[model samples]
Target: MRTSPPEPLAAALVEGRTSSLKEPLLRDGRLLWLEQRPQEQGRTTLMLRPAGGDTAVELTPSPHNLRSRVHEYGGGVYAVGGNDLVFVDDSDRCLWHLNLPGAPRRLTTPGPRAFADGLIDGPRRRWLGVMEAEGRDQLVAVPLAGGEPQRLHQPADFCGYAALSPDGRQLAWVEWQQPFMPWQRSQLWLAAVKQDGALEGARPVAGARPVAVAGSGPNATDAETDTYTDTSAISVFQPLWISPTELVVASDASGWWNLQRLDTASGAWQPLLPLEAEFAMPQWVYGMRTTAWDGQQLIAAAAREGAWQLGRVHLTPDRVGTPAAWEPLEQPFDDLAGLSAEAGTLVALASNPTSLEGLLELDLTTGSWRHSPAAPCPLQPEAISQPEPLWFAGHGGVRTHAWFYPPAGGAHAEAPLLVKGHSGPTAMARRGLSLGIQFWTSRGWSVVDVNYGGSTGFGRAYRERLDGQWGVVDVADCAAAAQALVAAGKASAARIAIEGGSAGGFTALAALCFTDVFRAGASRYGVTDPSALASESHRFEARYLDGLIGPWPEARATYEARSPLAHADQIRCPVVFFQGLDDQVVPPEQTERMAAALEANGIPVEVHRFAGEGHGFRSGSVRIQVLEATEAFFRRHFQR
Candidate 1:
C-alpha cells in the first residue's frame, strides 16, 4: 500500500496575524486583558470587553505598549479598580494612570525605576506595588493623583504580589532574596497599614526560615562555619486577604504547592483542602494568580498529572481545620493561568489541545462559560495534531513525561522525529494547541515535547531532578524520549532532531554533544557556557547556578565539564543557531563561540543573528525565518 505525501503548512499561517493573550482581569462585570500583537512589532495593548457586551475594544492605542520590565520578564503589568486603571508603560518604565473616558496620565516621574504587580488602594488614593530600580526591589506607593512614589517596605531583595486587606488595615505580599528563584524559596509577609500609608511591624508569616549553621561553607573550618546559614528552600505564592486578619496562600512545605490559610493574630498556618496537586506555578513574572475568593467559595486552578483544571473549595470559616469540599469544575481547557475571580465571576487565560490561548469567562452561579480567542487559528481541526501524553523511562530509570504529536493526518510509518525541550528548564510542556508544532506535523513530522525531570506541573521532588545536574538530567530525558518513540516504532531512529530556546536551548546543545540520538539540533539564544552564565547573567538569575550547577567558583570544574562549547568537537552532525543580538539573558557571543567551535571541527554549522530583538524573537518576520531555516536544515541533514 502507498500513502500520499502530507501537505506542508506555510510559515505565514503559523506567525502572521497572531496575538498572544495574557493577564485577564475581571472588574465590576467588565473583562480586561493584554494582547501582544506580533504584527504591531510585539506591542502589548490593553483590551476591554464592556459589561453585557459581546465585542471587545482596544483601550491603549499604538505606541502605548502596556508592559512592565520590573524583572525583564514582566507580568502583572496592569491593575484596575472601579473606573481607574494603573499600568507600567514599557516605553518609559513609569506608572501611568487612566481614568475611564479620558486620556492616560503619567503618575511616576521617569527614572530607572519600574513598577509591577500593582493594585489600587482606593481608601488611601494610591497605587501600591513592587518597584525595581538600581538592582533593588522595594514595595512602593505612588499617589493615584500623581506625586513622588513612597517606599513602603524593602523586606528582601525582591517583592511582589501585594494584596491590601478588604478593610484596608493590613497588607500581605510575597518576597524572596537572591541565590534562589521564587519557586524555590519565598516568604509571605504581613504588615499593618498606618494612617500615613507606611507599613508597621512587617514580618514573615509563612515560608522557609533560614537558621544559622556552623561550618556550612564548602572547605570551611569550624571557625568559619558559624557565620553561614543554609538558604531557605520553601516557597510561598500569592497571598490573598480574605479578611483583615485572615489570608490564604500556596506554600510548598508539603512538597506540593497547596492552599494554606494564615491567621494574622496567631501566625498559624492551617491546611486547606490538602491535596497532592499543585495550586501554584513558578513566579517567573509578577501578577500571577492561581487562586481567588469570589465572596463565597475559593476558586482555584490546580495542576495534576501534567494537566491543569479549575476547581472550587467551599470554605467553612466557623469549622476551622475541617477539610473543605473540593469540587473539580468540568471545563474544556487543560492549561489555565491569570485567574481572577470576583462577584460570582471567574476569568482566566485558558487553552486546550484544539484551542489557542483565550480569555475564558465563567459564571459561578450558572456554571456557564464563554471564550474570547486571542487569534483565529489558521488550521482546521483535522489538520491539528493533538498531543498524546507518553510516560517514558528517563535518566536513572525514573518515569518522565512527554507529549507526542504524530502526523496531522495520522501516524506515519518511520516518521522523522522532532524533540522539543521547553524553556525555563523549570517550565512545563502543556497539552495546548501550538501552531508551531502543527506546522511540522502537517509536513509528516512527528514531534515530542519533553517535560524533562526538572519541569514543573509535577511535584517539588520531580522539579528538583535537575538540581546540580541541569545538562545531564535534561539531556538524558530528551534523548530517552526520542529513543522511546523509536522503540515504539513511532519515529525513525536516524532522522530524529531536537530544538529549544533559552534554557531549553542548553538542553538541545548538551544533547547533541553528549548523546547519539539526535542527528541535528537548533538553539535560539542558548547558553553554551555555564560559567559565563553564572558570572554574567542578570540579577534575577545571578545565583541560579548555585542550585542548578553548584555554587559558582566552587564548582568551576563541573561548569567546564558540562559546557557544550567545550565539547563542541564531539557533535558530529549539522547544527544551526538563532540568536538575538540584544539578548541579555544568553548573549549572542555564546552562540558565536559555539558556532566557531563546531565549524573548526568540520561540522556543518549555521549562525543566524537578528537585530533589535531581545531574549525571545518578537518580530513575525524573524519567527518565520527561524522556522523556515530550521526546517530546511533538518531536511537537508536527516537521513532518509
Candidate 2:
C-alpha cells in the first residue's frame, strides 16, 4: 500500500469530529447506540443497528435530545425492553416511552426530579432506575403504564447503578453517604422486591447493618428508612446478578477493584479474580458497564497500567480460583467500554490509539469480531500521531503513567508540550485516538495525557497516593511528566503548557500556581478553590473533596492551603479558563475567581464562560472556540 503524505490538522477537521459511539444496548437481536453529531451542534441521537444488518437506523428524530443530566455526566439516557423504550429527555427531564409504532409518549410528569441509570424490567412491567428529587437520591420504580414514580429503596446521600435480578424479584444498588465519594467508600445493598415492586428487607452485602423497611422492619414509622450503614472504608460497584441467588460485584476492599461474588443466601463473598487490574471504574456517569453476564459465561473489561483489555470467563460447575483459569479474549482495541453480552454474542464500544471508535460485536463461539458503522480516519496515517505509553517517577517515587504523542513529522525538534490531565482525578486517561489530542500533535505540539496518581487502572495502592494529597500529587505528577519529556529532549521545558477539565483543570491551575514547570495553562471549569467545591458542588460531588483533600470544617485550613486561588499571587504565567455557566460540578464562579485573581495580579488571563454548556463542553461551536483560543494563547506564549 502506498503511504499517504503528512498534513497539518485543521480546525474544520476538529469541528467535523464525529467518532464517539456511546451507550450500546443489545436486546432481542438488535443493537442500539448513541452517536454525537457535531454538525448538529453536538446533538446526540439514538441509532439502531438491527441484528444481521449492515446499516444503522436513526431511531430518534430531530429536536429530541435523548440525554439525561441527572448526575451531570449523563448516561442511562435510554433503556430498551424488546421494542419498548423508556428514555430521559435532556430538555424536560421527562421519561418518554416509545413503542416504535407511533410517536414517543410522555410517561413521567415533568418536575425537579431527574431520572437516570434506567433499567427495564419487562417481567414486572416497570422501569427501574436511580432518581434524584428534592435534594435526595434513591431507587425508584416507574410503572410502564405511566403514573407517579414510586420510591423503591431507602434514601441515601446518593444512590445509583440499580440492577435487577434475573427473576425481577430482587434489586441491587450502590449507595454512598456524604464526605465519601463512590470511589472512596460505598456500600452495596441487596433488597427484596415487594409484590408491588417496592423494595423491602434491604440489607448491606458488604457494609453496614441490615436496613429496616419503614413500618415493616425493626425501626418502622413510615414505609422507608433513612438511617444507612456507615461503611466509610469499603467501596463497591457494578452489582450485577450472575445468577438469581448470586451477585457479582467489583469491590476495592481488597485493595484493587477486583471481581467478587456475593451470595444473597449466606451473604458470603467469593473472590473470582484477585488480580491487580480494575474490573470496575469510578462511577462518573450512569450505565457504565464493566462486566456482562449471559447466564453461562462472563465478558469483563479490565484495566491495568492505563490500558483496557477484555477477558472471558466461562461459568461452570467447577468455577475456581485466580484469573488464570479464565479464558483471555484477544481484541484489536486497547480501550473497551459498555460491554454487553447475550446469547453467546458480546458487544462493546472498543477503540485504540490508531483505530476509530465504534460498536464492536464479538461471536464468542467463532471468535469473530466486527465493528458497526465504521468511521474511517479522514486524515492520512502519517498525519496522525500514535501515543507512546510512558511511565515516570512522580511525587515520592510513585510510578505514574502517561500517553505521549509526538508532533507529526518531528517538525519541531524541541516541540511545545501540552500536558493534559483527565477529569475524575479518580478516572484514568483512556487509551484511544482522541481527535482533540491529534489536533495538537498535528500542529507541531507534543501532547501527554497523564494518568497521574489517584487515577484508576493502577491498583488501589497507587490510586490512594492522592489521599489527603490531591492538589499536591496531581500537580507534581503533571509537572514531573513535563520535565521528564523535556529531559528526554522531546519537549521544550520553557514552552511546556498544561491543560485539563474539571479535576484535571484543578491540576492545571495548581501546576501554574505552585510550580514553575509550566509557562501557560488552560482550565476547563477546573476546581480553583477546594473549599468552594466542597460546599457548592452538586449532591453527587458535594463531599468529593473530603477524600480528594479532606473533610470540611476540620480540614478547612488544608483546603485553603492547597487551593490555587489562595496562592494565585505566585502564578505569573498567562492562563486561560474555559467554563460553562451552567456547570454544576465546579461552579463557574470557581473559574471566574481564578481568572480574576490572575488579572488582579497583573498576570495575563482570559476567561470564557459558555452558555448552555455544563461541566464538559458538548457544543461544537464552543469546543472549536475553546480549541482555537487555547491554541492561539499557547502559541503566543511558546517561549520562542
Candidate 3:
C-alpha cells in the first residue's frame, strides 16, 4: 500500500462511470448505487446511492441537473435516470422509487426523447424497458404496488430488452428495425398474455427476413418512396428468458456472435455456444449484456479466450439436452464491465486498465462465484492494469479485437508507444479496466487499443467494415495497427504516439493527416470535420456521419478531404489538442481551426481547453490531469 503518486489534475484522462455496489437487496440487506461525481466545471455527475448500513445516500444531487443511471429493480427498486438539466438528460430521464430502503420516486414523465434500457424484475409485475423520444421502444408495466404505467410494446424502429417469463406468463422482447443497429441484427419478440396481464400475440423468434422500408412518415410526405419490402433480419440483440418455454440469446445468425438456444417452441435457434471462435464482447445494450436465469441456474457472459468471463450454460431447451458447461465466473476481469444474475447471486463488472477498479459481487451461494471488491476507488490490487486480449490482421484480412499494454514502466523502461483510437467507430476496445490506459502506461506509455474497422463482436460482414469506409477505413486501420506494432518489435518506431478520444480522435487526426504512422498525435474530442459530423452530432450520432463519412453535400469532397482540420498543412507530427469549450460535437472550431493549421506548418503545437466541459471529459481530477498531461506531452515532444 505504498502511495506516492497522486497530484496531477485536469487534462481529463478518464472516468466515464463509477458507482458499483448496488442491487444487493438480497431479500433484505438492501443496496442501491450509481454515483459518478467530479464536477468543478470539469462536469461529470450522476448520483443516487442509498445503501444505508455503513452509510450511503446521495439520491441524486450533485447539482446542475443531476444525471445518473442504475436499475436494480428488485425489492429496493431502481431506475435512476438523469438530467433535470446538467446538459439535458436524454437517457437519464428518470425512474426512481427506492421504497423500503427509502427515498426515490420519479418514474416516467421525461418526454423530450426519454430513454431507459436495463431493468427487469418480475414476480407479479415490474418492467420499465422504455426508449421513447421517437426512437420508439416501449414496455411499462410497473405495479409491485405502484400502478398506472402499463403501455407495453412500441417497436417500429427499436425496442429494448423486455424479458419476463418464468411463470410471469410470457413476454420476451429485443426488437430492432432501422437501417438495423443492435449489433446489426435484432428481432425476438414473443408476446402472449391476456389473462389480465395484458399483452397478446406478437411473434418473430429467429428474426425472419425481408428488407426494404422506404417511405417518409407521418402525413407530411412531401415526396419520397422507392424501396419497399419491409420485413427484416429479425436479429435479436440480448433477450434472456431462461424458461417459460426456453431462452438465452445473443445471435448473429452463425457467421459468429454465438450463444443461441432459443425455442419458445419451433421457432428454433439452437447453438448453445458453438459459433466456434467463441464469442460475446462488443457492446450489447450500449454495454452490459447479462445472461441470468436463476431458479436453478443458467448464468452467462461470453468473450472467450480474449476474456470477459463468467460462463455457465446448462439451459435445457427441453429434451436432447447436454450443453451447460461454460463456467468461468469472475476471474478474467480485463473487460466485462457489467454482468447479472440474481437470487442465487452473480453480479460482475470486472475491470482492466486500472484505477483501483471495481463493480464486482459474485456470490453463487458460496460454492463458487466469489469476487466482490474494488469500487468507489480505494486502490490496491496492485494499482490495477489488466486489459490483455490483442488479436491482429484487421482492415482487410479482417479478424480484429484489441487491448494490449506494456510500457506503464515505473522506473521508466520499455516506454515509447501509444496507439489507441477507440471511440465507437461503432466501439470496441474491451478488456476493460482503464485509467485512460493507465495515464499512458504509468508514464512510459506502450499501449495499443485499435479496435478499428466498424468493430462490434465481429459478424454481420465484420460489422459492416465501417460502411463506406469512414475516413478511409478508420484511418487506414489505425496506421496499419501501428504498423503491426512497429513491425512486431512491439513498439517504438521512433517513439510512436497516436492518442484518441472520440473516434479515437478521428484516428489520431487521420493518422497524422493521412498516414505516416505516428511521430506525435492526440485529439480528445476528435472528428475534425466529416461534413461537420454529418451536420452537427448527437441524436444518437445524427445520421452518424451519414453512415460514417458520406452524404452531406454529396460527401462534400469527402468532408474536405478527410479533415485534419482540412489537411492541416499535411501534419508532419508533433501535435496535441483537446477540446471541450462546451463542445457541442467536435467544435472548438475543430480544435481552433486545427491549431492554426499545425502552427502554420512549423509543426509542434499544443492546445487544451476544458471550461465547463461538454461532449466528454468528466472530472476525476480532470481525468488525472488528462493522464499526466499526456505524459508531459510525450516527454517534451518525443525526447522520451
TM-score each candidate: 0.95, 0.94, 0.33
All candidates' lDDT scores? 0.86, 0.81, 0.58
RMSD of model 2 against the true structure: 2.9
* Greater-TM-score candidate between 1 and 2: 1
Top TM-score hit:
1
Candidate 1 runs further than 4 Å off: 1-6, 211-232
| Candidate 3 lDDT, 445-545, residue by residue in tens | 56878777776655556657888677777777777776776777667777888888877787788878887768888788777777767776544455556
Pick by lDDT: which candidate is best? 1
For candidate 1, write residues 1-640 as lDDT tens digits.
3245456789887886788888888888888888888888788999888988978888899789888887888889998888899988888989999997488999988987788999999878889988888887778888999988777775447789999998888989887877889999888877788887877766666664563222211132334322223334689889987777889999888899988887887776678868989999999998788998877678999999899999988777653668677898887998999898888999999999999988888888888998877788877786678999999999999999999998755665578999999999899999878889988998889999999999998889999999999999999999999998899888888789999999999999999999999989999999999999999998889999899999999999999999999999889999999999989888889999999999999999999999988999888888989999999989888743
lDDT of 2 by residue, 1-640 (tens): 2133256576766656664578887787888888877667678888887877877888777888878877677788898887788888777889989885457888999898888898898877878887888777667778888999876664446778888888887888887777677777778877888676666777666755334433222233354454555554778888889888888888987888888877787766668887878888888888789899866788898888788888886554433443324677877888888988888889998888877778888988899998753467666665778878888999988778999888876634468899999888888888777878888887778899998998888888878898889999998999999988888888887788999988888899888888999989998888899888887877778777877788887899999889899999999889998999988788788888888888999999888889888878777778888988899888887744
Q: Please report, as a residue range, the 10-residue window in candidate 1 with the lowest summed lDDT.
A: 212-221
Identify the runs in model 2 with alpha carbons over 4 angstroms from their true place.
1-5, 209-232, 316-324, 411-413
